[model samples]
Target: MSAPEGPTFRELAVQALSSVQHGYDLLAPKFDHTGYRTPASVLDSVTGALRGLGPFGSGLDVCCGTGAGMGVLRQVCRERITGVDFSAGMLAEGRARTPVAPDAPRTDWVRADVRALPFGPVFDLAVSFGAFGHFLPRELPGLFAQVHSVLRPGGTFAFPIGAPARPGSRHYWELLAFDTAMRVRNALWRPRFVMYYRTFRLAEVREELLRAGFEVELRALEELGRRADGSPRCRLVVATRPV
Candidate 1:
């Protein structure tokens, strides 16, 4: 979960004791050292898929943590790119790390909560990476509605979703244990940290997206490879607002 430069156990423990926003603020400096940052391989795969779908005008990265998904937006979007998040520390780190050339597409960082995004139906494309677990199941309707509200007609909101771990598998047990631990911790602690591993299922997500006025489509991320049953290990969910 971490490299040599990542946070120590003590540091992580302290962060875990804080609210989700404050915890991320505490972790912002060393966030990239940990496994929480989305991998470049996943970003590249999404970029390739989106390149075919795009030449998009302006793009937004929803819940952009330290601007990893901004790389994907840069590759595919044409005019301007914006990243919005609730954490000031994370946004500051992103501004410091994300480079800009004189001729590069315009870049902007806005600090706002994703549940109530502050934007018009302006973006042609929007992408999020590995940040959905923070929201509970009941929040899906409002969350999807917020995303849908920010996309122009014919715009897309895209993200990757991994296949569930097979029952009885080691990975399955690991996730189950992690989620149970989180549940217990939230129950016992104040200022609950809302990160769980098992809540976002594809079928339920599709229903919510449709309810939010998106026409949903699922495409296999073939670059991520297939599982034992020949299903894709990861799939890209492309939800488009109607024109």
Candidate 2:
């Protein structure tokens, strides 16, 4: 499913007017059809990169909207895989679509905020995709700490970060305009829906990961190709909890 089958403009407008949680709830059923779901190519690229880094035992996907990251976990993890999200509607969609078969490793769905992950040092690997923009930069220290707390010693936390949109490019201006509108809407609105395209800079994220006690390394996801200057289009950040 793609844009042609996705929500209408009016439907999207109603969703944008709603609170974040409620908005996703309204969007969940049609999410797979929307452009918002991370592309399978990106997921495949990350999974390929993580394969060399793991034979991870148990995996967790934080903010696992509709379980897009679950297939990645299924490929790498040996024992169990879980996806956690605050949106019950998203979780329900994920559950309905989860491709578990007889003898497959257990897949669990938990509804919880990623800022306050609900587990101990049990998972051997954790991942998140396309969700960080929802978090304020100030929330990252605590958020990274929470992810750190949930990983077993030496466990990996990985996610993909794309290069910032080029200045003066159509993409850049589009994001700037969208963010401007969102800021104005939030200022005038009741329930603030936090989503920003330009907030999660790689440098700041790396610093916060270090502060959270992660040993961070970044590897290019070459499958996504490189930019004009030869920089990777996307880099996968692999942060490991200390042994």
Candidate 3:
């Protein structure tokens, strides 16, 4: 269910019709109220997971929409934190929502496409949340390459991914219907809005990350619990640039 303060159906419809960047810009104000924003529970779980591996220095949040990942970076990173995305509106909201405390690390926001990050090997850690659905499977190689390029040798790139919905489940059908609708909408629309729930699978993603020269590890987010088959319902993908 959507939050009472979240966007109305009409607002969501308008956003769905716009390009990804523009749609996010239009949705930025009400984004945190929507179910689209990463949940606090997930953020806290990630913080707990990364805390064990970290005490990292500078950190980056890729495709940071309204600063959810920035909050995670704040706890894990000691030196500085940067949030990057193509949407100015979303960045503005992020900045407003996440004010820098006197003792907090220096925070910066950069406007650029993640496909070609403008930084060198600078960050010690990086994290992203709920944003991977925008990229097609074929783009994973280049996307992971870009992420790999921006991290210092031995720096970590981490993100959470949910297990695929079980076949015939309500969630499975919901996701299938959503992707189908998006495909149809894109075929008929001018500026295509790209977002699909089913495209990012772990096996294909692991291969791409390996091809991009990162040592990969999977840690179950036990806080999220397990499936009936005893597999983790959510797992953290930890990819580290080689030292």
Candidate 4:
């Protein structure tokens, strides 16, 4: 995919050296310009898939950086939409850009950690996009449980999951090098920035959702096309908080 408009090299370097919260805050003004934002194609595919399941009441966008998922919720949820993340600057940028139509659900931007979301069983749907790499695998159970706790029984938490990069592929090596660099940087730095492309294993994530009391399902996103092996390039993982 093409890269989004983003920050400069020196700016990125400064952000990378800072703490995660501060780093994102520094990048927030130009975040949408960055490739870190979720792609419109993925968002559209999810919006299409969720349309069949919907006419939902309220929705939450977990770890919403710049409100792409919030826009998705606006299309489907009838009552309210909330975007939660710990980064104050990201929330500010999201609020500035993600305006609701007069006919759309009312929107709220919350600054809170996704691991400890501050909501009860009030939402009929929750979604996140392109935010999983920021979370370590070990924290997923608690994280999924937090999402589960905020959803009404039978509510769904959905996100796009791409096929793992094949070993020795260009993408695979790029991710490997990036993760290695991140590990080294974190080891030598204070207040680690936790992001690893390889850590969000689908099987492990499905198991964690199950342990969090979610019945999981995966639906191919046909719009994104297929891999060389004919498997879907990306699948939307829908985990329901069972009633």
lDDT of each: 0.95, 0.94, 0.95, 0.91
| Candidate 3 local lDDT, 163-231, one digit each (tens) | 999999999999999999999999999799999999999999999999999999999999999998899
- TM-score per prediction, in order, is 0.99, 0.98, 0.99, 0.97
Q: Model 2, range 1-243, lDDT digits (tens) per residue?
A: 357878888889898998899999999999999888999999999999989988899999999999999989999998999999999999999999998588667999999998888798999999999999899899999999999999999999999999999999999999899889989999999788888988999999999999999999999999999999999999999999999
lDDT of 1: 0.95
Model 3 global lDDT (CA atoms, 0 to 1): 0.95
Measured over all alpha carbons after superposition, the RMSD of each candidate to the real structure, in angstroms, is 0.7, 1.1, 0.7, 1.4
Residue 67 local lDDT, model 2: 93
Error of 3 at 241 (Å): 0.6
Q: Mind giving the per-residue lDDT tens digits that candidate 1 earns over 150-236?
A: 999999999999999999999999999989999999999999999998999999999999999999999999999998889999999
Shift of residue 156 alpha carbon in model 1, Å: 0.2
lDDT of 4 by residue, 1-243 (tens): 214467888889888888888899898988887778888999999999999999899999998988989989999999999999899999999999976478878899999988888888999999999889988888899999999999998899999999999999999999999999999999999888887889998899999999999999999999999988899999999999878
Decide which is better by TM-score, 1 or 4. Answer: 1
Cα lDDT over the full model 2: 0.94
Q: Which stretches of candidate 2 lie over 4 Å from their true place?
A: none
The TM-score, computed over Cα atoms with residue i paired to residue i, of candidate 2 is: 0.98
**Stretches of model 1 off by over 4 angstroms after superposition:** none
Indicate whether candidate 1 or candidate 2 has the larger TM-score.
Answer: 1
Report the lDDT of model 1 for residue 127: 98
lDDT at position 48, candidate 4: 98
